[model samples]
Target: MKLVGKTAIVTGASKGIGYAIADHLMTHGADVVITARNEAELATAAKQLTEAHTADKTKAIPVAADVSLAADITRLFERAVEELGPIAILVNNAGNSTLDLVENLPETDFDAVVGTHLKGTYLGTKAAINHMKATGTPGVVVNLGSVETFGTTRGNAHYSAAKAGIDKFTEVTALEAGRHGIRINAVAPGAVETPMGQDATTPEFTAAWHRTFSVERMGRPADIAKAVVFLASDYAEWITGITLLVDGGTHLRGLPDYADFLLPTTN
Candidate 1:
């Protein structure tokens, strides 16, 4: 119960990596506010979380909002303070991606991908930092990054760009917020078996990808979740501004050829 009295807000927590982060936070005795664009899914996640953690008296509040919108981000923080307490942690894990070559990708697609990943992280971090500063709380912010940021993966130019931005953003924000006693960092996952990951690649691709990992297995959402929990905990009091790669040492080997599986093969 490292986070017994702390309250957290996790964006895009309806499912996948986001959901796993919330679960782990609650496991450590934090009251969590989970947000996503899908109302039904968010509610379901909240119910499951509440039921699962009833013994710990940890509450999970679900708010339906699009993190890319500033208005929604404001409301999310407000709700967290109103319903739970001062926000001690913020996880900017909401993201969406469309695979396509740079030239083939549409402008709107680029905007959506970048907006949700990069812009959403910015908005959520800004709100969390402001709230923490005002409340005199030394909170932590964990932004979601990707191993792709450090390597090339064709058909994911936009995704890689946004994640790379997040890496730098986390560092700069950590520098700015550190003086205020707030810590900001990022977790970069590689080929996690989430719905998004599965949708982006096939079994064949996953098999080949796993073989490249020193761990000899694909990542699980829980693996990333555990890393987030560690960074958010007091154990990492001196850690900030770094992008922690929780990719089972996959970064050491570089990313797989996603284009071979995602893009159409022309004979």
Candidate 2:
């Protein structure tokens, strides 16, 4: 129970990587306020989390909100404070993407992708830092980035740009918040099996991904979740402003051509 008294707010926690991060935080004895756009899914996740950790007295409160909206973000933080006291951790894990070449991608699509990944990070981090500073709490913020920022395949230009911006945003925010006893960092994950990534889990794609990964296996949500716990815990008290790649060394080889797998005839 490294975080027995701490409270965390995890955006996009209704499922996938976000859900895993919230679960791991609760495992380590932190109260978590999980948010997602889907109210039903968020409630379900909260129930499961609460039931799983009843022995530890960990609370998983679900708030339905769109992370890309500043008003919603503000309400999320406010709810957390009201229900669980001051926030000690914030995970900006909400994301969205549409597959299309830059030439064909729509402006609204670009904005939507960038807004959720980049703008959401900014808004959530800003709110968390302000709350922490006011409460005299040395909190931590972890932004969910992606290996696409470093090695991206085609049709992911918008995602790459947004994640790359997150990398820099983490650094700049850390520099600014460090003096106030706040630490900010990012975690970049490679291909992970999740509902959002179901389209990429075909046999051919799985084989290619396994061959390309140095670990010879796909990443699990728990893998990334464990890393987040480490960074959020006191073990990393001195760490800040770095993008930790939990991609199973996928960057060392290269990202598999997602288009090749999704659109076999396009090539």
The residue-by-residue lDDT of candidate 1 on 1-267, one tens digit each, is: 399999999988999999999999999999999999999999999999999998989989999999999999988888888999899999999999998888788999999999999999999999998999999999999999999987897888999999999999999999999999999999999888898777777777888788779987889999999999999999999999999998887888888777777786611
TM-score to native of every candidate shown: 0.98, 0.97
lDDT values, one for every candidate: 0.92, 0.91
For residues 30-128, what per-residue lDDT tens digits would candidate 2 score against the true structure? 999999999999999999999999988898999999988999999999999999999999999998888777777899999999999999999999999
What is residue 63's positional error in candidate 2, in angstroms?
0.6
Q: Which regions of candidate 2 are displaced past 4 Å?
A: 265-267
**Alpha-carbon runs more than 4 Å astray in model 1:** none
